[model samples]
Target: KPNSELKLQIFIDTSSLEIFINDGEAVFTERFYFDNAPQVWLTAKAQCLTQVYRLDGQAITFE
Candidate 1:
C-alpha cells in the first residue's frame, strides 16, 4: 500500500482514548485500561520519519 501523510491527535480521558487522524479522515477509537500508565509507540518505514511526544512536553526522534 502507498503511504499517505497523516496527522494524528490523541485525546486521553479517564476511561478511554480517542484518536483522530487527518481531521477524522481515519479514526481508531477504543477504551483501554492498564495497571500502569501506557506509553505511546509509533513505527513507520519506507522513508518514514517519526516524532514522539509526551504529555510532559518531551520529544524523541525515531527511525
Candidate 2:
C-alpha cells in the first residue's frame, strides 16, 4: 500500500519520550536525561499534517 496514510503521536515527559503510530497501533519509547526545555524537528515529503499540544493543563496531579 503505497498511498496509505500514516498517523503519529509524540509525547515528552520529565525524562522520557514516546511515539505512537497509527493511533497507538505501534509505538516507540525512549528514555533520556535533560534539564532544559524540549525541542522538535520535522521533515517530510508530499505535504504532511502536523499538530502540537501542551501537557500543562491535560496532566493530572495526584495528591
Candidate 3:
C-alpha cells in the first residue's frame, strides 16, 4: 500500500518552516508571524495536512 503523509517541521530561530510531503518528494518553505496567536494546531482534510505554529514557540513537529 502507498500511503501519503505530510510532515511539517518548524524552526523557530530562523522564523521559518519547512514542509515535506511523502518523505521528500515535495517541499515548501514559508515564513509567518502572529502577534496574538494561541497554541499550535494541526489540521488534516482530504489528502492534505497543515500545521500552524506560534512564533513564540521553540519548535513544532507534525507527522
Question: Per-candidate TM vs. native?
Answer: 0.57, 0.74, 0.37
- Model 2: residues with Cα > 4 Å off, grouped in runs: 57-63
Say which prediction, candidate 1 or candidate 3, comes out ahead on TM-score: 1
Model 1 bad stretches (over 4 Å): 46-63
Ten-residue stretch with the least lDDT total in model 1: 50-59
TM-score of model number 1: 0.57
Ranking by TM-score: 2, 1, 3
Clash count for candidate 3 is 0
The local distance difference test score of each candidate is 0.72, 0.86, 0.56
RMSD of each: 10.0, 2.9, 9.4
Expressed as tens digits, the lDDT of each residue in 1-63 for candidate 1 is 257777778876555788988899888888878667767777666565655555554558899
Please list all clashing residue pairs in model 1, or write none if there are none.
none
As a whole number from 0 to 100, the lDDT of residue 9 in candidate 1 is 81
Best by TM-score: 2
Question: Higher lDDT: candidate 1 or 3?
Answer: 1
lDDT of 3 at 57: 45
Full-model lDDT, candidate 2? 0.86
